[model samples]
Target: MQKSLRVGQILYTNVLPVYYYFDQPKFEDRIQFIRQVPAQLNQAMAAGEIDLGPISSFSYAEHASQYVALADLSVSAKGRVGSLFLFSKKPIEQLNGAKIAFTNTSATTVNLLKIILLKFYDYEISYVTQEPVLEEMLLGADAALLIGDDAIQAKRNSHNLHVYDLGELWHQFTGYSMTFAIWALRKAAIADHHDLIAEVHASFLDSKRKTKENPAPLIDYVHTHFGGEKEEWVRYFQGLQHDFGDVQRIGLEYYYRCAAELGLLAAPTTVDLWQAGGRQTKTTLTR
Candidate 1:
């Protein structure tokens, strides 16, 4: 029997469409899907606990040498992603030097928030990682960064809290879409299953196609499994994007550039993109 593929999946609603098919009994023999938050999945991929899955964009930069981008899929947004929000009692300008608690469940959004504050908003603030409880995070701090399902829930119950969509903020700061997460495969794992790459890639693409073709099933699944009004969930899904095309690639590269400038990495690393046709491309970069 062939070895089962170990796949990591982010439990965020934004990614459920891609993960929908994996839950079916047909895929059980071929794969083992591990659901986790973005940060935890990143750590798992880095530690080789899982073979491949969507990972935080910032974490990919930090671990670029360890994995390869599985082109054609990502969790991105043009603007106002709804799940990545910065809630504050005061305006962003007034929050300079303020204590802000960010969810430890994410790394990309935290870094992006810092970039927004320093580069665009032009101020330095103190940030600490904390549990993703909006109320608790804002108890002693001026603001809190909540993301994924927790952030969505916070928005639903937002009473007097100033909410800023990080996706819109990133777009306004830089005229480009934000690629929040990318499906990355462990290099060694992929190499071991080189002959099966095309089959695996096609399966995922088919799943995404099925998801887009008829969103009713997905929305129903979300409502049943995740709990949200159908109308609200529809709008939320509409705002999210998963195409890893040129536009998203440019945006991701720009993100890496900003990360590099912030000293997050020594320099922008090459994106090893696995093309849809099962070909590999080494994307070179400078600055």
Candidate 2:
């Protein structure tokens, strides 16, 4: 008997490539994935709304035991990740007294921004999650964490605002890949539908390739989620690459190390995603 595995994904342009299930009838019937912002997706995963999808790295750490990570699969760039951003109406130091807005889309970026504030700038700022608009937060908070399309448009300041790049922040702090999210599965789901996980991953990869060859199907989806320049969004989708291999471990470890350094987690554990626990032997990317 075959059962569809429920999966969850974030609502960002960079993540659209993973939704290839929409076009594949075979995987579609077997997939019960929901598209939501990272934080919401994390909640869905924790609540058993879906088995797995790309999730915020911080959320994974918070509930490490509940899920197993597809270590090779993640959203991270070596440098210059143009999506995540931190903006303030004043200098980072001056931002201490001002109101700032944070995006509610991702749990990981929130903490990631906090690390930059506490460590790099030496600012004891009050962090709050208010709807992200310069007017809404600048009216009351000191700084804001903006991500995805909201970050894209809002962070582009006219010279008065100070922007602290989260990707660059992580690069400066840890020399490995700064993983934002990875395909994650509920711990129990792996026990029953392990093979389906691989198949779905393959399906996702195939979709990514198809989108890369012709992004027309997702252009609107990408433009809507990414927000800034249409060409920039198009270019972003062109650059996304998903791997199901060890290339992601360093980044995963780096994320955990950074979280640990910030006292976010006590001792983090790494998943041998090659075998992914419960599985019998190491399976290389045959997809």
Candidate 3:
């Protein structure tokens, strides 16, 4: 018999479709949801604490051998994922060597920022926790990376902060969408129930129909799931974009190339994505 599935998810607002899925009695018992921040989610997955979860794309590349991406989901906008913010009291260039505040909330975004800053921006800044206070970052640092709700809240400040959205930044640099989170599974576990991966992707598409039209129901679902402030979560979900779009999406290529450039992967290649009707075969990355 197949083992019961354990699922993990980040508590971010972009995951409403997955949350709404629990409404279906078909999946409720078999699939258990582990509500956690992205950073913790990835660690748990790496440590084998959970079998499946929406892992940050960076982790997929970092720990490629351990996990295989099951379904494409939780991507950032091409030109604007407002939730990812790079705030600086000083300019990026000016902050040569400083302590940068990082939201330890997400591994992918944190690593992405680190790579971008080190490789492209030439910023030699160390990452510090977002807690204790923003005041700490302000006093002892050059900039801060605040993501999700924290980023949203920081953006509202009256102070002048240079906010560089990673999606927009990557699009301007590479002309491709940034996929933030991907549904990933333990590679060993995928052999027997690969069909279930397809089903989950199908399920995401079906839920999108109900969610794509009206924002209220999805928002309500988020509020119920996380016990968060409803109106804000609704507006945030309304702003997010979630179309995996037939598998030939530009985001996958961007991921491959970036991974290669970082020497995380040997080469770049197209991902052979599968839609609802068939079992998806894994695509090797080659340039």
Highest lDDT model number? 1
Model 1 shows how many backbone clashes?
0
List pairs with backbone clashes in candidate 1: none
TM-score of candidate 1 on Cα atoms, chains taken together: 0.94
The better candidate by TM-score, 1 or 3, is: 1
Give the Cα lDDT of each candidate.
0.85, 0.68, 0.67
Badly placed stretches (over 4 Å) of model 1 are 284-287
Flag the better candidate by lDDT, 1 or 2: 1
Ranking by TM-score: 1, 2, 3
Count of backbone clashes, every candidate in sequence: 0, 9, 1
Model 3 Cα lDDT, one tens digit per residue, 1-287 = 76666778677767766656444476666666788878888888888777776877677666766765554455556667778888888766677787788877876677667657766676777767766245556776678787776676677772877778876776676666677777777766666656765566567667766677666777776577656577767656655666654432466566667656766557654443444554565665332
Best TM-score goes to which candidate?
1
**Model 1: how far residue 48 lies from native, Å:** 0.9
TM-score of each: 0.94, 0.82, 0.80
- Minimum summed lDDT over a 10-residue window in model 3 is located at 269-278
Candidate 2 lDDT score at position 193: 82
lDDT of 1 at 41: 97
